[model samples]
Target: MEETDHPQYCGIGIRGVAIGIDSFVWIALLFVAIFITAAFTGQLETGSPGLNAELSGAPASMALGLWFVLALGYHTVFEWRFGKTIGKALVNIRVTSEDGSSLTFTSSLIRNAMRFVDWLPALYLIGIVGIAVSGQRKRLGDRVAGTAVVGS
Candidate 1:
């Protein structure tokens, strides 16, 4: 009857590990973006050994916005298209609708957007609590989006 009744849910611990892997990947991509941006903006020069990361003002704001967009898009695109990110696939877990179907683009976007709330007050502390107590092993994002992360 309700959308939260997912079967074969995974524990938050495994989810945590999967997210760690995903985060690592995101950070790597971001680093590459920063490197390229710096080069194009002339922050790097001939004989320069590394990128200068001390950029500020409008450039810093733009970089921050780019980071947010990339983070959102990374999760949204992977979950919508593949049901799982690389980390989730590697960990044998996936995001699926509450009724055990592939997530829609809307569902994935809603869930990923809620990631900010899930991280409120700390590093996913709210999400961890939600999963630990939601009875369906879901975080805020999953509940909001009518989705679940479960064994693949």
Candidate 2:
């Protein structure tokens, strides 16, 4: 019998692990960048009397803004260029179009952009439900972008 053209979609177990890895990677990178910048800017010097080294007020807001931009960029750029983030690559999986073709940059951007919505009420609960109910195991972002995560 001839084989059907169905794709082997990854389950939440593997996808969750991949995202966990990616989150760690991004956080580490963000910290490193912040440390280097602080060092260069004398923010880490702690040389003045009655001075505290802490993120607060403007600094806190700026850091939060930076984190958002960097995280979004991290996901969007990686998937757009490689069809997988470093985490997904390590997991031996990659994102592809529903038709099993390599995804375009717009597709990657659209999916990654919807990540915040997928996060839902908290901790990807909505995404989990979507994946569980979808025939292709797609999360909100995947369904919206017509993409799937599959073994590479």
Candidate with maximal lDDT: 1
lDDT (10s digit) by residue, model 2, range 1-152? 02128667998999999999898988876775565445544675454574333565666566666767788888888887888999999998889888887788889888988888989899999899999998889999999999999887
Q: Estimate each model's TM-score.
A: 0.88, 0.83
Listed per candidate, the RMSD to the true structure in angstroms reads 3.5, 4.1
- State the number of backbone clashes in model 1: 0
Model 1 misplacement above 4 A:
1-6, 36-53
User: Candidate 2: lDDT of 37?
Assistant: 49
Top candidate on TM-score is 1
Q: Over the stretch 17-90, how does candidate 1's per-residue lDDT look in tens digits?
A: 99999989889877766666666566644556744555567666666677788888999999999999989999
The C-alpha local distance difference test score for the whole of candidate 2 amounts to 0.81
Error of 1 at 14 (Å): 0.2
* Candidate 1 clash pair list: none
